[model samples]
Target: METFNSSKDFLRGINKKVFIAVLSVAILMTTFSAMAIRKDVVLVCDGNEINITTFGGTVESLLNKQGIEIGEEDKVIPELHERVTDGDRIVIHRAFEIQLVDGNEETTIVTSRKTVEEALNSLYIELGQMDKVQPDLQSTLEPGDTIRITRILKETITENQEIPYQTTIKYNDDLDYGKTTRIQEGRSGVKEILLEVTYEDGLEVSREVIEEKIIQEATNEIVEKGTSRYLVTTRGDSRRYKDVIVMEASAYTAGYESTGKTPGDPYYGITRSGTKVRPGVVAVDPRVIPLGTKLYIESMDRTPSYGIASAEDTGGAIRGNKIDLFFESREDALRFGRRKVKVYILD
Candidate 1:
């Protein structure tokens, strides 16, 4: 009887121990199930699903629990640290970087836009009427797309230019040199120049060739020669003619006609003192203002005066303060009129 009782007690204790062990396993399983499943939350980040086992109540906590760290350059559809619930969609985007260059200068721009045109419009690159760009205005933009801007402002410039007068020449004698006999004289020349220019921000940029032409032609001239002559009788006695000095010169038609313009004869209006004179020749009488005497005279009408004259010949037209002016043309000589003028004797 006592041996059977001991067996029964031992069997009973072993059954109780097995039951306790089973119950503890069941409790552990129930706790683990509670921890693995969260029913009151949702994930806000796009491009992500909410199947992860994060018992944490918030999106940020859930990410940390999953050992995922958000980057500064990265983007999330649902903001980090946002409370999440079931049936939520989360999106994650990696940031893109772009570098820009205007001419030789460089700059950096960060944008979320996917195309170049979008980025430019966002930055307000074109601020005014003068700003310009080179690409097709409606071209589609993509990443790494490069666009060039040409900010050239065009302007027109006009100027009056001086053109040098070229002498009218006819080849009197043919030779290889640059010299040509002048058939006519030169006057003046003029021309007009129009320039097209481009600038940037009021600074001169480039000059371009546009229209060029000659507007007006210069005038030509000719020099004329005279065929008149004359002679003179001195105030001093004829016998002492050699001793008398002429204070001034005058032209007498008789002597000039004989010696003047004659190839072999001495030059016209030659003074007795061997000095050469012309129609305008006004020399001091050697007797009055010795040979080589310096004198200043008002030759042209009330115009500027001249200096230093010597005893020259007498002429038919010249008398007292009177004088004749020589000119390249007969018309030019005829232009001068008879007038009273002063003859100054320079010491």
Candidate 2:
């Protein structure tokens, strides 16, 4: 203890020791800072984060160490490879999925385009005349957004249809010239057409159908169709004589037919049953013009009586002395029609 002398001397030695200790501590700290690894870094992908150990200062270096490479358009937490600190938060992002659905077409996209038009045009899609767009064609694209394109086409087509003609027949001998007959009949036609159609939004937009020509024509048919072709005219004399119908007729009647017998059939008037009648025969009331009464009726058709007629008939369809006239053709019967005419009693 006596080696160092007084109190001042002892204090000086202690101060020097304290200074040396501090100096040594500072040097050790500096050396360790240069050699030790940096603290762990937190890297976030999406919303979740993971710890990464690195000795890098900037994000770019740390990512390189972590085997992560980023593109210009790739998403990042702090943006493209920023400078980082020990506890700094770093985020790495990859492109999200995008899908495009257009009518029946579906496209899965994996692009980093920022605009809708750029995305669509990138795929080389063309718009049509009536096609429609969903996003107005100018909208910006988001991380996971999609764009759609629609197309339309238009065209026309043609088909077929039918038409008809006219013909004539006459009993007046004044029928439309050459061949004349007491019957009228004829046939009809067929056609072809064209149609035009338009389409939009993958559906038929509109159609215009046009009728064009008759492919097969119909000829007029004549009931009792004119069969008679050539007729011999009266030679030279030029006499135009029309036939006359006679009201008088002869037939055997039962003696009891006291009021005189009525006109019968042209060929067969008597019935096999001994009943003095056939179907459709009409017997008048005696006070008006008794049974077996003969009446001359006129104005049935152009010719008074051309076909065979008979009174050897009676029917519920007949009334009074007004007998129903019968014709071979149903059409002729209907054409003769139902009409009121003058009737004269002649026994």
Best by lDDT: 2
- For all predictions, the C-alpha RMSD in Å is 16.7, 13.7
Q: Write the per-residue lDDT of candidate 1 for residues 1-347, one digit (tens) a residue.
A: 99999999999999999999999999999999885665444443434555554444666666777677776766665677776665445555544556655444467666554455656676686634666654555665444555665466788887767777754444422232233444567776667778889877456888776776678767764423321211121222111011222233222331434335543565544555566554434433344445554334444345433333343543443444444333334454344434444454433
Question: For model 2, what is the alpha-carbon lDDT of residue 250?
Answer: 17
- Candidate 1 Cα deviation (angstroms), residue 263: 53
lDDT, residue 347, model 1: 30
Per-residue error for 86 in candidate 2, Å, reads: 6.5
Model 1, which residues run further than 4 Å from truth? 1-93, 127-145, 162-167, 173-179, 183-188, 199-347
Native RMSD of candidate 2 (Å): 13.7
**What TM-score would candidate 1 get against the native?**
0.33
CA lDDT of every candidate: 0.52, 0.54
Query: lDDT of candidate 1 vs native?
Result: 0.52
lDDT of 2 by residue, 1-347 (tens): 56656777989989999999999999999878764656667987655779977665777777777777777556666655477667778867565457787767777876555566766676677777567676767887766665666666667777665455565533334332244453544556776677777766568877787657767777775533332222222232222222222232211222223123344533244442234443233333334444454444444434443222233444333454344554434455556565554344432
